[model samples]
Target: MPVATPVFDLSHIYKLSPETEDLRVYEKGQIIIEEDNGKLFPPSMTPDMGIGTCLLNERPREWRCNRANVNGAVGAVVIAIQFYRHHNYIANELHELNPCWDDERLYYTARDINIAVFTQIYFYELLPILLGKENMIKHGIISDSDGFRDMYDEDVLPQMTDEYHYALRWFHVIQEADIKMYDNDGYYLNTIPMVNVSLRTGFLPHDENLEKMTQGSFRQYGGGFDHIIDNDVSNKTVSHRLNKIRIKYSCINLT
Candidate 1:
């Protein structure tokens, strides 16, 4: 059965329930701080930063937004920062359009639009690669002729299967440990161990780490499509063990 895209909703990004959402708000109307224009991440005032320490030093949290999952990997944090900036940008733009809109309204409107775009990208752009554009079109997942078409189905509730998270684990095979930083002009700056920067926002402030990490986004590549997994992810990260456990317990049950 065909289901609506889950990414369009702000389901996972922010808690829909009033209880959890209330806790996320920092100021009366404003939510937690998300950096604007790829600037320095908000200071780590608490363990929510998920700052982890290593031989070099104790890394501090850079982003002060809702989630601080250190295990999400370095690339995940970088992507989050970009999305965070996007959300803030949209919020400011909405604020300009409707001066009467409170901070909460602006924030949520921005978040909704951001999630919508994110959903479009995944469904239209990313999914085509694996699911095939022709297949998607045939199945009516996407339109054959594009304008505006409503495919919204109210009956289907948003949910995920145990296999969903397990499937995302494939990224771990290609996940790189050392990320190379660069400048706007493509100048090589330095390399940092991704583990060192996890949960530590302070690493972004001391130098050009923030800018450099942003620049690295274009230059860096995940591991190749080869069947092999990086040693760090397999051994040090224990992603392999996790995968085995999931396969043994969860996937088998599904079958």
Candidate 2:
């Protein structure tokens, strides 16, 4: 089903409410991260929000972040973790540059920079690969030159249409099922079924899983943009059963 996309705000990072944001914050403008058996992991969700459906029976807590447990795929979780770390790293750097700045100033500044970094990656790096750079430039979706392009209109509210939301589902055709793991040295490690990692964030902190998965996220090839849909994506990932039913009904109506 099509859903509305809001403006390019990093709600996923800062969360929707002051209470949730407070829970994730550590002292000195850092997000709360825990050290478990010498490896760093996101702070554990208290009271168990029931999102970690695939988590091991022994592991009751999911990673504490606004959206980390939403899908809980290893790739998604790792990226969240990276941004959490990056935010703190930036906060620390800002403190060093301006020692007089208070925690609030440092935190907000770092958050702004983090959002900007994400925007840069989306526009300059990811979009060019997905939609040909030339096409994006031609459509004015992105600027062709390094100079600033003032396309913003105060009257126009940034909103994503239902059609645009539905169109994004096409990327599922390229969703990879097997998440390959590699070491920092680029040595191939074992592959994990992407299904196994869904909602099973507890798996990331153990046995160098986080580090290996981080390596693989950048190194592994995405599923080919071909006719075949990955079985795990079709059968196991969250919401697949409902999606299957939707597809079935749509086909029946069409036929």
- The backbone clash count of each candidate, in order, is 4, 0
For residues 52-147, write the lDDT of model 1, one tens digit per residue: 321122323333333422223345556655555566667767767888877677766777788878777777888888679999999988877656
lDDT of 1 at 16: 44
Candidate 2 lDDT (Cα, whole model)? 0.64
Cα-based TM-score, every candidate: 0.70, 0.78
Q: What does the lDDT come to for candidate 1?
A: 0.55
Error of 1 at 232 (Å): 2.3
The most accurate candidate by TM-score is 2
* lDDT tens readout by residue for model 2, 1-255: 212221244554565444444534645667666777586555665555543343432344334333333334455567766776788789989888988987778888888788778777878789899899999999988888876556657796556676665555666678787889999999998987776665566677677888998888889988888876676676553433334322221222223
Residues forming the 10-long window of minimal summed lDDT in candidate 1: 244-253
User: Candidate 1 regions off by >4 Å?
Assistant: 1-12, 16-30, 34-72, 102-105, 237-255
lDDT of 1 at 200: 46
